[model samples]
Target: MTEQEQQTEELRCIGCGSIIQTEDPNGLGYTPKSALEKGKETGELYCQRCFRLRHYNEIAPVSLTDDDFLRLLNQIRDANALIVYVVDVFDFNGSLIPGLHRFVGDNPVLLVGNKEDLLPRSLRRPKLTDWIRQQANIAGLRPIDTVLVSAKKNHQIDHLLDVIEKYRHNRDVYVVGVTNVGKSTLINQIIKQRTGVKELITTSRFPGTTLDKIEIPLDDGHVLVDTPGIIHQEQMAHVLSPKDLKIVAPQKEIKPKTYQLNDGQTLFLGGVARFDYLHGERAGMVAYFDNNLPIHRTKLNNADNFYAKHLGDLLTPPTSDEKNEFPPLERYEFHITEKSDIVFEGLGWITVPAKTTVAAWVPKGVGALVRRAMI
Candidate 1:
């Protein structure tokens, strides 16, 4: 580990395994090096891993107890702030923090979809935008605008900022998202792209940040607020060990695949996503997901045993919680008359290989359901 990890490891909670850094949400796990110089106490305060991911995204995932991460989201309810909520293009379902709009009542929320670089190159941008808007609607949000961007590629950053400036109208704007959705990265880019200024803000690994918020000042005397990202529900991070989180989370571009399937065949898209026969024959099925994840094909007859034998090792995120506690594999069968795109949640999407019927499966909570073709 590095010096920062070494310092953070010195801290551990007496009741839980999480670490405590700054109470600043943007600067969660932000302990000044000078603070440690004062002295070391032996009671065990917060966990060390929390410190690294918070400040560095270095992957120190701590096991948080219920109270450990159940932060005061209601605090924002009373603030008259413009909400800029970011969601990962991949893992959209897992990234959703429920009751967000209700908690921040009357706040105008702008849902920004980040990491568009992972999508298939053939995806039609406008159609995808509409799909995202529909998802936001289902999430109980009437966003002032829904913008798609890739912080890594700097795609659509200018347009996003321009729109935000127009809507912001001299109001305090807060950026929030569930953990691992690239919220900090987006904010970092926004600072550099919009202002050409570099300012240090808070970030951390475990959710329910120790720090409450970070403020980025604008020229109009308005402040752009960066809030702590909440831990997502049913995410692989929550299900897997720290080692697994690194292995599963994509750090690069994704690759899409096309497979022709019959009635009795199964295609396993990595350990996190699966497809089983629900009775479609001669169906053209394509899948889009992260390239890092492996895709294994097998006969549907052996699908169950294959999953049982290779889960985590193969069909991963394999129940860090417990075997039965994990979502059972779910199967969905669909018929397509035309060429279309089939998305596999955090995984990339597969283009239909033309005029074939197919079935797909995924863990119930990992979000492998099919949406309208975004072609």
Candidate 2:
């Protein structure tokens, strides 16, 4: 090929699928010029972001506008593909892609709930899957099947592959999810299981790690596509710094903490969320959060002043520097007619009993809602 032709030839990142470039380190698919020559010789290439993520366990922020994601969805809508929709079991509501059913056209969706290991072991699989199915239906999606797996722990990964294999039927597969839902990790697990390659795609705790679609060819000449995670602005992850994200996002199975409270009491989940027991008889409230996160209790009347006083010191997680920039918590009140969980999206949840009236507070623009108790 001519030198100009070689220079103009597009080379895509094997990890993220962005066009490889040596210019503009801040831009997508950037790698050093020396690394480009090395990649050419090695016949294996990754962009700088994925390279750092794989080797150093470091993450860099990348932007993907809604229009870009929409264009991707349009491509999926036009393709003959099986849509494998992944969602964080902990942040189900926040992980949903808005109007996804409308975007998938006639593609069959296989709903996979990731981070299942984060839930208490006592929680029944059937019940959890039922809850997920119900939630999917509510979102106007009738998934062919629902599977629960923990990509981090490599739990139920073989079963997930089997289900995908059964449903894919020689067509291409497209895995999709909102940011921080473990989609990349799940894809990495699949790559290891299928091809025996480790960490083929970048996986990190941060949001928006995968900036473009990565296609992995199957033996049948079809491919499995890993799409960039859609940004959900309402997620609490968007508000917190990386340090606080580690505190909010649980790493292991949650140990439920039960508190006996009277009508006028409050529980602070770090400085990130609040649970107020507003009315009804004294009862036990169960909290499900990261084991390391501190929960502080105080009288409901004194909750406001207490939060203001101890926010950075005792309550923590908006750390000291973050507290000043942290958005104010917005209140969401619910009268619990039955057993339910008041979820502070991206943060953890509190299980409240029937006949209790409670209020949940999360940062403004973050989602807080009630769902049937999972445990």
Candidate 3:
């Protein structure tokens, strides 16, 4: 390498695969100037963000550019690879990456619905798989297969590996998802299960942990590539702090909460989301969210003032960090002619019965949608 080449030579963090640089503190892969210099001699480095996550279980927000993820998708489009598209079963809408069909080209996609451990044990796997396939088809992205696995619990991993092997057929395997979908954890589990190497890649609840794709060689001459998660603006993970995330992101199985609401009643999901029964008869609605998250109910007429007065206190989950940056709640109205789930993007959804009318409120850009009920 020439002197000019040395100056431009890319150095990536071994822990997270982000290209190391010293200029911008807030940019991806930023390290102090002295640390960068020291790393050049030691050959082992972690970005400032990863260092804290590794040591203190703290996550500093550093977003990966959409262009970088797009470039990786473009590269994968031309390769003969098996696309293992991982999605969080709890937050399906927020986990979806739009335009994925255009980028995957002709590759066979294997939809891996992760976080199965968070669901009730009584929930049948076949029903969940059918729902996944239906949602994929509705989004115009068809998968050759759909498998449910809880990467954290290491459940159903061997069966997932068998499915991967059956479809990969001597091609590279690419794992992809929007941020916070447990893609990194799933890949790490796969690595440990297949290669006996535990956690070769860094894992965290934060988005953009893997700034670039990392490839690990397989015994069969094929490789498994872990791509940096695409940052979806609608994902709540982008707006939330680490403490708020712990409260909303369920760590254990979710026990569904059922509420009976009349036409003029409202329910609040922490301080992050709200649901109003705009024009429905007295009915039952089932909510699935983090067990620890607080749920508040009040008359619809009092909701506005209640939220304005007690947002960070009684409503909870706003914490100090998110209180200022949190955008005003935006409403998405729905006239549910059929049974459907009113989804609050990264937050869990409320399943409403047919012939009900409702409106959902979430922070701006944190999406809300209504889909045919998966249950």
- Tens digit of per-residue lDDT, candidate 3, span 234-308: 988877777888899989999999998899999999999999999967999999999999999999999999998
**TM-scores of all candidate predictions against the true structure:** 0.73, 0.96, 0.92
Q: 1-375, model 1: which lDDT tens digit per residue?
A: 666666666463321223444333343344444443432453323334333444456653333443333454565688777788899876676677787766678888888998887766677777778888888788787888889999777788899899888788678887878777878777878888866754233343334442345567888788887665676655656544454456556666665566777778877766666666445447666665555567788898898899888775655555434555655666666665656555555444555544455565655765544455554
Q: Give the whole-model CA lDDT for all candidates, comma-separated.
A: 0.63, 0.90, 0.87
Q: Pick out the ten consecutive residues of candidate 2 with the lowest summed lDDT.
A: 1-10
Where does model 2 exceed 4 Å of error? 1-9
Q: What are the per-residue Cα lDDT tens digits for candidate 2 across 1-375?
A: 666336625887777778888777898888887888888889778888888888887778776687897788678988899999999998898899999977799999999999999998899989999999998898889999999999999999999999999999999999999989999999999999999998788888888888889998888999999998898988999889988899889999989999999999999999999999999998999999999999999999999999999998899888887799999999999999999999999988899999989999999999999988877
Instruction: Please name the candidate that would achieve the greatest lDDT relative to the true structure.
Output: 2
TM-score: which is higher, 2 or 3?
2
Count backbone clashes in candidate 3: 0
Ranking by TM-score: 2, 3, 1
Q: Is candidate 1 or candidate 3 better by TM-score?
A: 3
Once superposed on the true structure, which residue ranges of model 1 sit more than 4 Å away at CA? 1-58, 62-71, 194-199, 202-211, 309-370
